[model samples]
Target: MYSTDRRERTQIQQLTSFVKAWSQIDPATAPFLGTWTAWEETKSIYPSSVKGRVCIIDGFIPNENNIGFRFGQGTVSNGRIKTDSYILIHQGNYLGGVFVYNNEPGIYEYAWPKPLKNPAELMRRVPQSDRHRNHILEQFQNAGCTASRPNRR
Candidate 1:
């Protein structure tokens, strides 16, 4: 049990490092690191099947009110990457697993389709809380990364 617990802790640390690295390298993912609202106002329309569901994907998991650009396979563990992968909770219940990471090119494609049509449109539609989000995204878009992929090794 002690060994299992130690492995779990180490895995969490590894995954956090991967997320931090990926966030810095990918502009679209950077803003979401700190801000993800529950969007309680839209809960009545469609509730999250799992309460308090927080997992790192290319983007935040979109609840009804949280509709936005989301990339990557729904489950990171589904990928074949050895350094960064998903960790299953148990047999037959993969949804609850947390993704673990240790290296480059996370399970999701770092480059995602533009979520907003244009900067002007984004400025009009973005909520005050998310203004910075659009700005950073636009900067990266204008810089020609468009997808913010790390330089090929």
Candidate 2:
């Protein structure tokens, strides 16, 4: 079982690679696509997506809350990705599985469009509270990716 830090570190690296190869990302084969849940009140794992839903494609996060920007851009250079969803402004390394914006936090594991290849094994390493519960499943099912998700299921 990989530690939370390790898993998130790897996930961030994948996100970085995704941004670097944005133009080549085939939505049909993208791996990190899912509904990243935002918490308005607290990052409590019960009711998901309080603030809004954002999907990280190769380089954009389709904004649902009308946060001024039409689409939150994820541009990576010098190891730092400046994004409203993905944090770590000072530290260029480790973007985290959870995203924070305007005080609200988002958990990456909340939504999975398709069942993971090794969901059991992968989820086993995660903390009980952090395991995915299909929290934002309904949203993806309703709206589809819309540039905010990885692929259309």
Candidate 3:
């Protein structure tokens, strides 16, 4: 099993690498993201607003429903966006990951399921209880997702 600390470190490393890559892009070539934009000094993991929008550059885990949801204005503060503005990445029956919520109009959510060793076998093991199913469905929906039924094994 992977330790949470290890996972967090890996995530941070990945984000740092992404920021480095973005730094190489000339502002003249990609004006959409802006030339002044860069990762925040305090939170090197977060992408700073280049043109009034926070860009999410982290790579998402496959299969896990990683949804991004908006909770409206006043959600952001102290140069940091509100947690509700972002979607919580779900790992199995628990919350495992997250990404910044954009400032775009209307609440947007995304859902992705965790990668499975054997998709068919995992599907077969899905609980038959309506309550369980409903709970899972609700989690994904609340995060602005409707479940991700990916075809993979």
Q: Judged by lDDT relative to the true structure, which candidate is superior, 1 or 2?
A: 2
Question: Which structure among the candidates has the greatest TM-score?
Answer: 2
Candidate 3 TM-score, true structure as reference: 0.20
lDDT of 1: 0.29
**Model 2 Cα shift for residue 56 (angstroms):** 7.9
Error of 3 at 114 (Å): 18
- In model 1, state the lDDT of residue 59: 32
lDDT of each: 0.29, 0.30, 0.27
lDDT per residue for candidate 1 within 84-103, as digits (tens), equals 34432222101122444565
lDDT of 3 by residue, 65-118 (tens): 322111121122333333443432222322222343364434222222122111
Alpha carbon lDDT of residue 147, candidate 2? 31
Q: What count of clashes does model 2 give?
A: 1
Candidate 2 off by > 4 Å: 1-15, 23-53, 56-91, 94-135, 146-153
TM-score of each: 0.21, 0.24, 0.20
**What TM value does model 1 have?**
0.21
lDDT of 2 by residue, 100-148 (tens): 6588886432221221222222223333333131333333334333333
